[model samples]
Target chain A: MRRADRLDRLQSALDAGGYLRLKDAARLLGVSEMTVRRDIASCDGRFAYLGGYIAGGLESAGGMGYILDRERDAHIEMKRTACDSAATLLKPGETVFIDCGTTTTHLASRIPADSQITVVCYAMNIAEIVCKKPGLRVVMLGGLYHASSASFSSPESLEMLRGIGINTAFISAGGVHESLGISCSNFHEVEIKQTAIANAVTKALVVDSSKFDQVKPAFFAKLNSFDFLCCDDGIDPARAERLAAAGVRIMLP
Target chain B: MRRADRLDRLQSALDAGGYLRLKDAARLLGVSEMTVRRDIASCDGRFAYLGGYIAGGLESAGGMGYILDRERDAHIEMKRTACDSAATLLKPGETVFIDCGTTTTHLASRIPADSQITVVCYAMNIAEIVCKKPGLRVVMLGGLYHASSASFSSPESLEMLRGIGINTAFISAGGVHESLGISCSNFHEVEIKQTAIANAVTKALVVDSSKFDQVKPAFFAKLNSFDFLCCDDGIDPARAERLAAAGVRIMLP
Candidate 1:
């Protein structure tokens, strides 16, 4: 497992459970207590060290940009392959909305250097990468900063998003299930994702195969909400057929 | 010098002179040609190395977010000391605007991890630093991304700035003169700086003594625009006194 993904999983566990015991976080993340300790340390002041438990400050302030930087390396190949598949759908000069997610980050990385596209983003990491491409205009939504997401979200951010016309949007979520549809762990993020989907002409849910059939709380979109679903081949065959039968276009690796 | 600051300085030199010979950049930055070679190499497609001179993509883009990253280390001690003096003016819980500049990045770094303050910024580098501190809310004004500045700016960005009421603003500039006042090379940046000064209750001009008495093209504010001037004591006594007499408070380190 990649360390960034582990750290993100650890943060999710902490946010869900309020506090995570070092042993449990390590066991769930398939790592040692030492790695979990290091993850917490790398988080700097975002996590409070309470003896055996790590307390993540997800709700202590507004819109903690919850992008776990280290998580980018976790499941690296799967993310890259999935992102590459997603890129096949993009055309030059199209205006795209990229949300803050470890997997979606790969799409930004995969974007052609010389592609003249307008990227609408909500985070620093993506902006840093996308802005370097010459002749591209990056519109970053501004508002309350969420340290964990590493993106901005608030009334203002949503208002800003409403002003842009998106041709295609690659949205991300923590999990998807037949019943729950699509969801992420953080409830604060759901509305922004929904808003992006609402404003986009064509919307695709870009998640890895591991997220298939799983369900997270704070549902954002229904299964039919998206025009396409982009994921790696790790998806179960049976579930893929079921989703495709339900009218969701699947972008396969 | 840090790699980011070095790249920024190289780009600034490239922007000013249009072309920079390899030997000149190495000699000017007081680094080895090998290090300069690596910077051009690491610009990661931003620069085209044509024989002996480095080519930057300046005119081919918009707003260029040119707050020099590596140049933060150019006058390392002096910039830090000037920023340290500026830090003394900050109070807990106040909303402060930190503009994109090498010297102001020092202020972001120097901010105590435990200090509870709201940071309003337009760039990712400072947002990444400021959002790490727990209990602080970061409001990043988002708009069109400028690759060189590594920040966002637009007419809409200025509109957004007009809405926010700032307690203090630590503004940066390329030059400061008794006559031309505070200015920067980019004409695109002047309006935003002017808006920040107008919205700020109290403002401080933060720059190294190197900028003293020099003048850049796009003047943003006058000597009396700021409540305090934060710089190294390397400033000329006569000039400082003349400015002090003109009602500009000086914060020296």
Candidate 2:
């Protein structure tokens, strides 16, 4: 088949499935994965190639939001331990803000089913889990649903966060550099996270040890902004000392 | 155990599980289901027993919202048929509003994965399913999470709906009375439904045949407010004709 024919077939498959994996596109077009990649590259701005999946131009142009599933199992046990330690800080009757991320999902689950606390969240994954508990009241921030993160965000959601009195804010980050500050993948999340930090009595940064020293695209807060850090025992002693010296307490599980 | 002790154990279980079935509560207290029901009844304002499940006082006092799971299987095939018919009205590139309810979930699923349309929804269940499709841009109106309905609603969600341009509003209701108007179980859903109806170009009411003649607590719209009724073959012909004569077209699968 001609290269044009192959590209047409790939486009048809993407139109049908909404998205196609690179390998799937190759098989559907009867070409090698490398050929499929080259074909997609040839069509500038025609498709979004993110995390091995190809999506239509409309979605690509809108934004290729963060894909949470790929990062879900990256550091599973450590995330759970970190979140478990973080969950302990939540007291009954207080309102807490749970940030949007896979690590915070573990914290959402560790929350006592009958804690009688109100949970303020912006992510679907976190809200769905806690909403079922009859003892917990859930305040969900609404906005445009980003398929990339399975989370909601808008100016209205940020405004909603400001009005709520949060006792503690359990925040998640993609990177936690001492000097460069804390960051996450989506730019939409910055204002909401910053608002939570400003309004909450205690701002707790909950992340696995692997996030240390890494800097993601959207920076939200500085390291000193958090009251403390909840993480697993995988942190290097020197690194822990550095954070501690920087006036950020590291709470390990 | 004394009656007070049994009540204490029941409260503890309800706290741990958020909610418990009557049978499980009885087993945990080592008593008959009837005895457990009596105990819950004796507690009066302390416990909420709804649809065979026992929940804590906080949830019980905060309005026993409509439970979607219990109604999920009732007339399910007919609901699916009705929603399937409703889903056909959707066109690519048009923005639509999907109302919250178990029946609407079918419509959410049947939406073409590659139809480049924007879906505005207030329910977590509806948002979670449609957000994964790459061709769909989802605008989720967020607010307090209602566990009974697996939906979100707030004053701001209504405000958010007012600003968006909705081409079609696919509404679901608990009751569809001819003279009494359309109604739902929760009062919070009323304003959102009314706002969507007032703003949209086409208002379609999607309900199973059983909903006809039923009168729920919250009334949101009159029968003539809808442009069409998408329902199953089970709808009584006489009733369909009456609705048609009243200026509402009935679209069936």
Best by TM-score: 2
lDDT of 2 at B86: 93
DockQ of each two-chain model: 0.15, 0.14
Model 2 clashing residue pairs (backbone): A142-B142
Model 1 misplaced stretches (Cα beyond 4 Å):
A1-74, B1-73
Native-to-model Cα distance after best TM-score fit, residue A121 in candidate 1, in Å: 0.3
Q: Model 2, range A1-253, lDDT digits (tens) per residue?
A: 4886566445433322235667877876677999988888997755656556665422211222234324433675578778766877889889999998767777776677687899999876676557656788899998887655567888777877788999999999999998899999989899899999999999899999999889999999999998889998998999889888888788876
- Please state the error at residue A204 of candidate 1 in Å: 1.1
- List, in order, the clash count of every candidate structure: 34, 1
Q: What is the lDDT, from 0 to 100, of the residue B97 in candidate 2? A: 96
For candidate 2, lDDT tens digit of each residue in B1-253?
Answer: 4997677555533332135668877876688999988888887966655566665522311122234324533665677779868988999999999998777877876677699999999876676557657789889888887765667887777778889999999999999999999999888888899999999999999999899899999999999999989999988889989999999989997
Docking quality band of candidate 1, CAPRI definitions: incorrect
C-alpha lDDT of residue A56 in model 1: 53
Model 2 — TM-score against the truth? 0.74
Cα lDDT of model 1 overall?
Answer: 0.73
